[model samples]
Target: MNIPEYLTSGILESYVLGAVSDEERREVECLSSIYPEIRQELDRLSAALEDYALSYSALPPIGLKEQIMAKLDFGTEAPPVETETPVVALPADSGPTYKITWIAAASLGLLVLIFSFFLLSQLRQAQRISATLRDSNETLQTEIQRQRDIRQRSEDLLAMLRQPEVRIIRLKGNDKAPTGEMMVYWHPHSRQVMVEIMNMPPLPANQQYQLWSLVNGQPVDAGVFDVTDAPQKMGRVIAQADAFAVTIEKRGGSPAPTLSSLVMMTPVTS
Candidate 1:
């Protein structure tokens, strides 16, 4: 297993923050048990988060206990009973009972208040961790999709090259770009055309490379394309071409080839 890659994947952080799904949580537990490095990192992240939460904790104001107790309305003592006989005096210890009860009530309220503060701090920390995990997941997904696209393009090019009916045409450089080179894959029966860029100079803004197919000495538009490493499908060749050419044109291309901007061309071989 690639231990370093796994460590930097952000899963460990999510697990430590209690934000992972059940399956992921189990995976982390299983890995941590087997790998000491994972276990150590997990411990470190957990301790760091705890310390962060504590750093933001706010202490209650002084005399808060006394203030809460003062606001509590302990019910008034009962009035002395009206009796025909002599009334007995109450015990001294019994006089302190109400005071003890009020003190207990105040302590319980203070405990609840402190617990609420701790819970709020924990919730905020979880939110920040969740945002970080979300961004990491998005970036990972984009990279994965990009790799898939490149693989698919390569497979397609290989399949096209293997077709018996497909003809390979190499267009070499002209005076405008002596080092420019590109390839065209043309299927006569299907009239499909694909271009692969080998080497070309960068174009200015609002300009693109346009392919032209010469049929009976007349220029026919094959399509506009950008210079890229991957083979790109272009407009179909409607008829058999005597030659293939490339020229610089406006971004969307023009109806007719720009003769002065012609950069590459090659005659078709039987």
Candidate 2:
């Protein structure tokens, strides 16, 4: 808007030399379109610089000029390009605009290439991680199946120990109970034992069910169990048991079954 300050800013020099950047050139173009004074100053400065360049131009050697003029006159075809910048044909040099556009386009293309490469690499990595997780899930499933098979076999062996072919002994609850009863599972082939108690009263905290094997009419301690609604069987039970009896003994059972405290008596069928 101010002619003096705009002229003093050296933009006129840059425009005349075609050295202005694209952004600067666009700004100058807008100012020239809107303000007549800025355009007047640019034209005046450009003419002065053009005249100074022409002032340094010297005449060609005498006959060389005549020979060039004679050839120009004789040729009827198009004239050849004589200079890099043709002052009469162009108002401002357009070469730099093409160069800047090419640079910007190449920069955009390189950025797109890099972004596509990065996205593709991430996709491949994600696929690999998913595959690894899938393999881990498969391994866990296989291990679970194996553990289930082992547990099923153990349950089958326990069921066989309670089979009817194995001997059984029924014991009726005595003074401690009026109508309660208990049963023992005995296998002569394996010499393993399990016991089940039904309708028995709860034992005192420090007391438990003690099973005794009667050998030669003397009580040999089989082991101890805790009977509630369900049966509680001792582990690795039979040594050499003939008949079985029950008593209320202290926890962990006495070394021998207490005679006076006997509850039920039942002989082994085998």
Candidate 3:
């Protein structure tokens, strides 16, 4: 059940004040044994009531005390004495009783103070836990959104590859690297281009693979790319090209292709 809501519904206060029905009283008793928060609240409420009662404690009136003493003197079962008897009663000292009463009151006040401090500490600890849970929940939501975005991108790429009109160009290895092979998916209708690295030798840290579009018998820089199993988008195909080629270049690529570094090229068809 919603324990916090139940506790804040003011039913516990009625239960503490002894105003609840028998059923409710039993329910509270049963839950107190099962839930620590409920039990702690019950204790705090009871302690508060006891402290209130002690705060207003008062002695009996003087007239009421006299009547009580007179009744006690006459109601005794001792028989009346015929001879005169001397009444030698010494006055009683109530110093110890008064001191003990104050001591008990002081101890009760101390206990109430300690209970208040404990309740405050628990409240602070609960707030800290709530804040931590809130932060963790936010982080989890962000990660979930990120994964969903990645999944959508993968689906889009797969859809592009399934298009029958998309041109699949197989670029073969050249003298620079005999075993290098790569595939380029050029979707002219959608103006999208992607590259799949099948087998390409790894390059040094300061070098990377770059793609070039052979347009009008001239090499136009498509973009610099990396060799990964997953398909990587090389931006849109802006120029009409007869064939595509791959070359190793400086890390950030160059304005024009480096012919000596050409590692692969699309087959020349006549």
Top candidate by TM-score: 1
Q: Write down the worst ten-residue block by lDDT for model 1.
A: 89-98
TM-score of candidate 1 to 2 decimals: 0.53
The lDDT values for all models are 0.79, 0.69, 0.75
What's the TM-score of every candidate structure?
Answer: 0.53, 0.40, 0.46
Q: Please identify model 3 stretches exceeding 4 Å from their true place.
A: 1-85, 169-183, 195-235, 242-270
Quote the positional error of residue 75 for candidate 3 in Å.
Answer: 13
Q: Please say which candidate is ahead in lDDT: 1 or 3.
A: 1
Per-residue CA lDDT of model 1 for 16-104, tens digit only, reads 65668999999999999999999998999788766655555454556665655555635444457677555555432323234555556
Record all residue pairs in model 3 with backbone atoms less than 3 Å apart, i.e. clashing: none
Select the stronger candidate by TM-score from 1 and 3: 1
Kindly state the number of residue pairs that clash in model 2.
Answer: 0
Superposition error at 7 for model 3 (Å) = 29
lDDT of 1 at 70: 54
Write candidate 3's Cα lDDT for 48-98 as tens digits: 867766774545444654454454453334455677564555333223333
Residue ranges of candidate 2 with Cα displaced over 4 Å: 1-158, 161-164
